[model samples]
Target: MSLLASEDLAEGTHNVKQGLPDLLRNTHDVTSQWMEENTTKEETELNDWANLPHVVLENVFEQLNEVSLLRAQFVCKRWYDVIRHSASLWRDKSFRFSGRDPRDLTHGPYKYASSFTRTFGRYLERVEFKLFSPVTSSVCKKFQKCVKICLNSLIKTKAHLKDFSMPALQLDRSQWMLYREDMCSALARFFCKSQHTFERVDFPGTRANFDDGYKILYALGYNTGRTVTHLDITDMMISRRPMFDIPQFVECFKHFRCLQELELNYSYISEDLLEVLAANLQENSLQVLSTSVTQHDPHNQVIWGHSWAALANRCRDLKVEFYFQRVMTYEQHFRILLPQIPLSEASFDGCYFADRDWQIRPTIASILPRFQSTLERLIIELPDTREVFETELLSLLSLCPHLWYFKMSAYTSTRFLDKLLEAVSEKRCNLSVIKVRIYVRDYDTDHEEIDLERIYTKYRDLITNDLIDYYATCCVSM
Candidate 1:
């Protein structure tokens, strides 16, 4: 028996039993008989309200949605006491708007709850923001208002905005009067309102003209301290104005000494701009840097010339990435800086085709042999061509013994794939993931889609059963 139960039996037997005399017993009996008749009113009034399963009720309340949960809180003081003490019940309810709805009542109501629930919700350790925008101006106004309200609510609650994506967007100047200014204002308001709470910021669009839009970000990054971790700003058309203001922008990053991963999208960066940005980030000791740019043509006068070569040499310790149309020229540039720093991963999307006006495919394959030993992941996004996956492409890949991941897309023939796989049979490194975007018929309308199934089946066996025990391989056709 438990200690309390055993102790209770011992106390009752020793104190109430074997101690009374015969006369005392008879007197006590007479007194008890009299008392039983009149003392019924004085018997301990048993309060059975506390007998209900309170722990079960607490669990059910936790499973309920926001609206149901609020109803439960009003059920009784017992419930209020239980839930008020439970902090984790509020952490999982934070959600972002669909971006399409203007007055979305359901978007972020957790952020707008009473101060008690709000305080509890601030303990959230993970958050994901899925960004979408309205198609028309009327809807846009409503959507913008919704976002503003949500932001206000979040700020009031002091919600921990962990991961957020603005989903980089491109706006046309003709769409509205002072469009850029309005966007900049919105961005500035967003940053200013939730500067401390917002941690990860993703610019979803590949290209954007830098203006006041960038300044708001600069200000936020400058003051937010080390909370920011991953920053993706790839494929952006950064205007020259933003380019000129880069020194100030970079200085802002110096304040965010905790930045780890940085991405630069489609930026035609000059040598000086690159040098400044790299120096600032390196001072902060960033681990990953991804960059994309249109490759310079010898015939075109837009080349960065020797300036880019210099920046590449300087940022040797950084994990550098470059995406371009002509992989050959980019590889050539990379080769010059390869000696200075060990660039481990490189992606070549949209290879040059001689017949399709991208006339540098021949030169690109020649440079692949140079990156064989050091390159970790080599992604080749092929263009639609009759003889795109030629013998020369397979031969170039055979040189990379250290290559862990290899992928090709856009209508590569089955026979060519077999040959390529056969060639890499022995030299295959520690490949873990491969994604292939399949070819589909072009559509004039917006409803067109790619055949993901066929692409997966084509390379299914090759990627499914990976060689490594802990490594997993996956392929996406679209």
Candidate 2:
């Protein structure tokens, strides 16, 4: 009886132990499956585009164009909310009104001018006026009226007009003669009125008489002095009136306390004006200055080297560009000016360096040393006949430890490319980009058969294996 009872109890205990393992295994499997499903659901919710943060949606909307944004506003309620709340999307609004039709000027049933201003004008930070076919008197009158209406709308809307650009008034000789003064006065009034908030004013292809130019300058100096940071008066036709002297004209620059970039293409820059600029330029704010110099008689002209040197010294971050229309001996001028400025960027375009006395290497050498610590960008375009020395080029590059962007059009051999790579390695130069258009002599067979692909492969190897990152583009010319 005892043995039978003991055997039955042992069999019962073994059955319980075996069944417990299966029960625990089944419980673990169900728990794991539930956890995986919950995790997947959470991840899907997190990655859903509709659940993106408001700031992210705003940023996405900022990249959309006006037409795309207008269409996007109707996509859904959430998108509409994002577009409406995103201030960045409406920060720098611009309004354009083309004066191709006389009816555009009138406040007819369409209310073309006022409707645009009333709806979107409050957000405008820029205004552009494009008047076409201003040849006939009627068209000219309409254009002028449209401009007035636009200006009045801007004033009424109280939009912060930071950038203002106007195309040149196209008119026939008779039309120009009839309306030049009135147009000048109207433009002057607009500038004067909007000067307080204007940060950039571009009046390309505008022809102005001496009086008009003076008025523009006066408006800039007195009204917009503290706010205007960028000014482009490219292709402005100044009357050859003897009454408007350079000294009086340059007096306006003295008031430019906030001017960071000034471009005066095809404008007269006399020695007296340079002197005035040297004395009065906003050193802390003036970062870019570009002008064209046309000195037909280099001998009789007053030397501007000292003034330029002074300017360069005072404005350490200045990127001075001089576009010479006439080929003259500018070596002396550059020699004096380059050593004083810590040029962060320099561009010389259409400059003739084939002059007998133009010692390119020495002039560049003198300039490169001072620019070594700060120079980041350089662009030089020279005559194809001008020779470029490898040693001088290497020396110049070695000095620029922080040169990230380089562009040059010159006569250089293939050895220069090798030397450039070696220099970058030796100097530990952080060169992110290099673009060279080398005019190699046909007889110089050393680089005539150069495999650019092989060079690029080498560059890629350096990037991948050595962790040196840079992009280089080399083109050969004969």
Candidate 3:
């Protein structure tokens, strides 16, 4: 029955979703009547509203959402006292800081609730930083303050810290030298207190140089690593003067007894750790190992003959992802990316690294032969607007028979993309999505990024010669 006309709902509201909305429409009047009728003369005479059975008020409060439930506290002094004193009321209610600025936590919409958070935070499931870009060096100190504040409020009422995703902290060289160690210590305390029964652990954009993000990670690996199902540190970078080296990660990744999905960058994982990684895989766990092809110790180490077969034998679902950051020398790519390992995804960040000395880049022709059948997705990115692929990508479409998603991004040149549109029409390939990135000088103007989807998608034929010609003429100004 509809809410407006239903007598049954008004009398006996069964579901919380159905009852809460109508009840919220008249909070003062309904709650006043509840206080009046639900209490006895002896209890009501002395202003003893606390004597109104706990279960009766709890049933009503439990049906309400966070905002309504919080509002319910002001009905009486007893109501305020009950909510403030009781732990279970706020236990499962999440404390979320989805704002971009530190001021948002201090002075914005959450300003009113800051006191509430401070009062009964430990019972909260977890503190979450949501829907914000990684903070820069300038505001890293302020952001870290917000993080510490949020964590500090959570007084450990129970040893039931389920899952945790550390907030993004992208500090510059100067910020790292000054603020990183103190912030690390703060996070270390949080982990030490509530490090039990975690099922998912994620620390994105972690810089693993020195003792930067190491102490926090070591604390985690020390406790909940054996139980976490998904462990993601893919975007972590450790170039030089590393602290959490190969052997530490070997011991760390070893503790994941029930790990189903792991995302690790090459800097954290080495050739020596691959065997350990292989052995740790549960029956269905798939490892997405990342590599930046360079003349580094582990990047240049051979994996084809030794641990590659062992990984394939143990885990059929093993998928390796390549990130061609800066300079991708052929020596490292060929050495590790062997026939036995299933090469699922390949990404080109740039054609060359910062180092000026020119090294031989392995062509797609040479590097992809072994796992062409296994290849599912190929992404090519050119940081320089003028830069295009060293090798033509038109032939790459045919090389990988099982390729699903092909993306050419971060470049202004649409010439290769035009050729791809022309070729894919005639000779059918297995490509499901073709994503191309085009650049316009001004960031604000509305423009559609060219996405040539599956054969059946109506928009596939939309990218005609006429459209490409139109794009070429007006792309620069757009």
| Residue runs of model 3 more than 4 Å from their true location after superposition | 1-126, 129-155, 171-179, 234-246, 290-305, 328-332, 351-362, 383-392, 410-427, 438-474
Q: Give the lowest summed-lDDT range of ten residues in model 1.
A: 467-476
Error of 1 at 244 (Å): 7.3
Candidate 2's TM-score reads 0.65
Q: Which candidate ranks first by lDDT, i.e. highest?
A: 2
Question: What order do candidates take by lDDT, descending?
Answer: 2, 3, 1
Best by TM-score: 2
Tell me how candidate 3 scores on lDDT.
0.59
Clashing pairs in model 2, backbone N/Cα/C closer than 3 A: none
RMSD for each model, in Å, please?
Answer: 12.4, 14.1, 15.5
lDDT of 1 by residue, 1-478 (tens): 8999999999988776666576688999999998986675444232233234767656666778877876766666777776666656665543444444654434343234333334554555444433345345543344344445555556666767676565634443333233445555665675676647555667656244555546666766765746786777654335644343345544555555555677764333434555555555445355666666445322122335354445445444456565555533433444433343345666655543523444235544655566566666766665544335456666655666666666656555445544544443444434554444444344321222222334335546654665331221222233
How many Å off is the CA of 300 in candidate 2?
8.0
TM-score, one value per model: 0.63, 0.65, 0.63
Could you give candidate 3's per-residue lDDT for residues 309-395 as a string of tens digits?
A: 776666776677767665455655666567777788887666523343323234566777677788888876554434344344567
Candidate 2 per-residue C-alpha lDDT over 392-450 given as tens digits, one digit per residue, 9 for 90 to 100? 66777766777777676777755666667655655555665667666644554454345
lDDT for each of the candidates?
Answer: 0.52, 0.63, 0.59
